[model samples]
Target: MRSRLPRLLTPLVRAALSKRVLPRVAFSGAMSAQILGNRARSITTYTEGSDLPRVRPHVWPAPSKDIMAARDFIRESAASPKNILIVPDREPDGMASGTIVSLVLQLLGKPESEIRIHFTAAGFTIFNPLERARLSRVCQKENVSHVIVLGQGARASWSLLEKSIETKALIINDQHSDRFLENTVAVSASRDPPSTTSSLLTYIVCSELHPEARETTGWLALLGIFGDLGARASLEPPYPQELKDFKKKYTSTHLRDLVTLLNASRRTPECGTRDAWEILQYTPQTNPAPTPKSIMKGEANAELRERLKDAKTRVNAEVRRCSKMPPRFSKDRKVAIIFMDSPYLVHPLVATRWSNYFDPNLTKLVLAANTGYAEGKVSFSCRAVSGRARKGDKGGPKEYETESWDINVISILREYLAKDSLLEEQARGEFTNGYKRATGGSVPLDVWMLFLEKGLEITPRKGDFPQKHALDYIQD
Candidate 1:
């Protein structure tokens, strides 16, 4: 009943024992404790786990006011006598959020026919006029009575979306909500660096419908969490109980691999979000639900592996080609612009790749602009230079507030657009869009050129950024 770790154990042996890393028997269990004196006690399975205090099942704090409001809205809407239109962002987190909504609705007895999933066009957030018009039309004919917006756009965009669509009730769930709208809820892992993903927030709200809501869709929730938060979801604390439960069932690496494969469905040139959703959806909503393993191993679907390979292959080639482009910083050394003409949607990928190499203090953001990604539009992706808040830095993302330590690159772009007289007249799609911290814009040729020539105060040399000026912001 008593045990003590021998100080004589080497670090490697200690780590092996602590992590249970020594194969089937576990390092600690493989060795029986030896008693040396009257004070010493012998215990088999000398696990570091045994030395630690027992941890209780994590109980979440009572849902916040916003969470309660979202819960109420979903509860009321579930029994609504009309169609509910679900508009998900066109990426992994969005898809996972939409799927969670669909499953929870069915759990609340809402029929499948009443739930409709709408995918916005690529390179378009809800802020895009084209997508807004599409949503307005979808809400027309008085058929869609309830609306749930998931996994994209900040609260401002969500506010505008609510006014744009004429639904009886609307719920906005996002990771970047500055303030809660009428029916908006925001969540994150910890308040400082990473936010609770949109999909996980949806699961938390849906749990009010039934306790099984969390049990059934915990794995699905991690899809969105990992898709948005990346590996930080597993690393960060204030960890969600649902996420903890999922880790019990699957390895962090395996979940990550699953997220990559599923994300590939949408990121490829073809954009197979629907295909991804089909494989990811938890059918029948029962205890023996399908898991990430089923999708990875291609259970009942051999084509999954092939499709994943095709998507990854195309993305890898494009990323490799565009990642070679070097960054050009602004006069103040705040913004680092890297321009490449790629036909694939690799701007975000290359921007993120470049972010890994940046100095968090010197480079505020890395903007990867792809002129060839969209026809006649210069699509750009923005990434914050990696850094964490120190003491007294979490007040705001502005230079003065955070010492530009954790820059709000989104605000910088938005401020430029708002102050510049040239961009004031530009339409929504022709300028800035996306989230608060992770924002980017699609600029037409004229605007793109003006931005390149005058905005950053950098002259685009043919050697530095070939097509930026040569093609007049168009990539031949």
Candidate 2:
């Protein structure tokens, strides 16, 4: 018999049908599933979702109107394009590549002959001369006419594209506030408050594109969104609800696992944009067969999923090692800093994992540094523990102040960077957001350690970032 509860008494009836009465029902499992389904529907149906509480890793809120504006921008941009090249920063980042894949899928209807991709180096790092040469040559060989930059395009890339002179159009679809030109087609949640690049891009493409394109591309955008905003999104109202709806359509765990796998695959020193692109190509499809070598060859191995699992195990082991060691406490005793002697490639990942292991009751902030003596630089990653009690939280948090401030760890590191003359105060955009609470970047290793040992009172040279860091010194 079908189970039916009276509509008027639904709330009271469900409440009364508690654990005591649950097992007594003939269709207990079905009843439980139905209740859960109803609850899920209610979460999306809540009137004017702004009344809903914010959750953490700090989702910056964007208004629904702005989300629609960004959507319209992308839809209009994608409507017409020929010989398109997806230019993302060459850094080994999952979100960066996720954006690339999202766009590729949006343009999937276009002939393969028309779509091409190039990954550019990040802004802070000096581009490899050979890689720059390769990029120029790739653009010419592919006869790229329209370029869609996924992240903030490095100045070096912009200059190279200009020099090539064949590109007639450029589109900036990034999350950052960087506006290369007044006409750059970039819509940023950061630039446009409360919307992340991933959220904006996902909303735009899904709402505008064909159903087939939306089905293929929508999940990749969510992966990118999780990569930037963490599992709990901080996007504006309808977007967050949109994310929840998307998650419900599939196994959320698979999306999370794909994000982890992308990070693990990109963790190695050998990985770059090409590997990221290959990984992106493989991520959207659900094939029972082994990962095809044709999809991802060379650094993009077919066994990457297994390899990522192994990497997580190793990273977890290292976190345990760091936990056993006595951390360097800040003078206030609020921050715990750990310095790792691990290889350059593993530092950020190790630091990120280690940050998750902190005793929140004891430490408010966690900083992890991996130094490269040979490269003469130290890469640092910092985080704020979510469990730490905030100053005003004695009674409890207010509606907006749901999570702790992201701790301004980026600004803290930047102060030392500026004090040492390695970076100017305005150059804070160099670091990538692995998570909202997590930020890290390479500073002059020798100069940073001096400030770490001595106070910022020490003066260093102006513009002395080493052309190559310790990561460059390592041989395969």
Candidate 3:
């Protein structure tokens, strides 16, 4: 029976192969053993349960013309003495902006010395004195005469605008949502015009790409889509043929990594800004492939990675310590609040690690950090979580119940003040007896408090507030 089956089906199989319409076949165990004859071992058959449809050809659209346009835009921006601000909603998004900024600067022949990059906090409240001082110092050191605000609502702070009337400022309105755009435009129009004669320009760069453009040029558009759209699965309009092709060739992870590297430079000052500038300069061009050895040997990559590793370790240690302590809300359960100082760009990792150990259902993660410099004020990042919501099945949880492992450290420190008498005394000038403090003595405290109130909104429950002078550590 087996031998006869092959004889009967040979002609049909060959005809189907020629027409590219081979019919699906199924075979049971040991029934038609001789059907394949001498080639039996080479020919395998699928059963009904098999998933043959999973096989797919790699199809990507060709590179688009818009890439070139994007490159040209960057080149033009870089050439002019303008400060470029790239703001993404998250660290990865911010990193993508950094990459775009770096590429544009390089293309415009502007050296690292002439470029300045800034990121806005998650909530857009810049009120930290330390951050303010740092921005002031950077402005002075770089002799930056212009500012470009990227992301949805980033704009030159009134203070920064007032400092030097000669500074030029531009805003790149990448937030495509009409609602967000309207809010941003209104905010900009309401602010007082800068004392400087430099002009402010706003541009709308969407996700769709234009064909005939270079890959480097199209990054911002793609990035805007990925970042602002919350990594939606569907592609957006203005979909150039080339962009579709690029998407097929590159996985989302690849694009994400590129953005992360760029952001790492800005988030980690210890890594040195020049290193980020270098990575951005090399990434956009069709340059030699970057090797692990090359990245390790590169001063910027090395410094950035080292600092990141150290910061991660520190955060892990803090989380562990907090976990061991009795829960502030419940004694028998696990309670933790992870805080990140500045936008260290490692909040997600830290949060994930903490969530794994403690029941994400029982654990509360808070992410906080600095966003950008606004009118001599430092912006902050803050988020909170609740144990009950973690265990719930709701698809989208409430804001207060959601955890932000990246809660700004500045904000956490401020919350500590609200709950601890020692911190409040220090803030109220009761700690030191009649002695004059330095210029920014309580600046840190103020920054921390603002982060807690504005960023996290973690108000104490009834009787949760600390008692007056309850803490014995209060110094005179």
The model with the greatest lDDT is 1
Better of 2 and 3 by lDDT: 2
Q: Candidate 3 vs. truth: CA RMSD?
A: 18.2
Local accuracy of candidate 3 as per-residue lDDT tens digits, 48-95: 798554422211111123233443455555666645443222333334
lDDT of all predictions = 0.63, 0.47, 0.37
**Model 1: residues with Cα > 4 Å off, grouped in runs:** 1-63, 155-166, 178-194, 234-237, 387-405, 411-437, 461-476
Candidate 3 lDDT (Cα, whole model)?
0.37
lDDT of 2: 0.47
In model 3, the runs with Cα more than 4 Å from the true position are 1-90, 105-143, 151-157, 173-214, 219-244, 256-277, 283-286, 289-476
lDDT of 1 by residue, 198-316 (tens): 77777777767876687777777787767776754442233454576687686677678878777676766677777776766654444457777766777735686678767878888
- What is residue 463's positional error in candidate 2, in angstroms? 26
lDDT score, candidate 3, position 435: 8
Candidate number that wins on TM-score, 2 or 3 = 2
Which whole-number lDDT from 0 to 100 does residue 18 have in model 1?
A: 55
Candidate 1 vs candidate 3: the lDDT winner is 1
Quote model 1's TM-score.
0.73
Estimate, for each residue in 366-397, the C-alpha lDDT of model 2 and write its tens digit. Answer: 77665532245566677765543334657653
State the displacement of the C-alpha of residue 161, model 3, in Å, after optimal TM-score superposition: 2.8
User: 1 or 3: which has the higher TM-score?
Assistant: 1
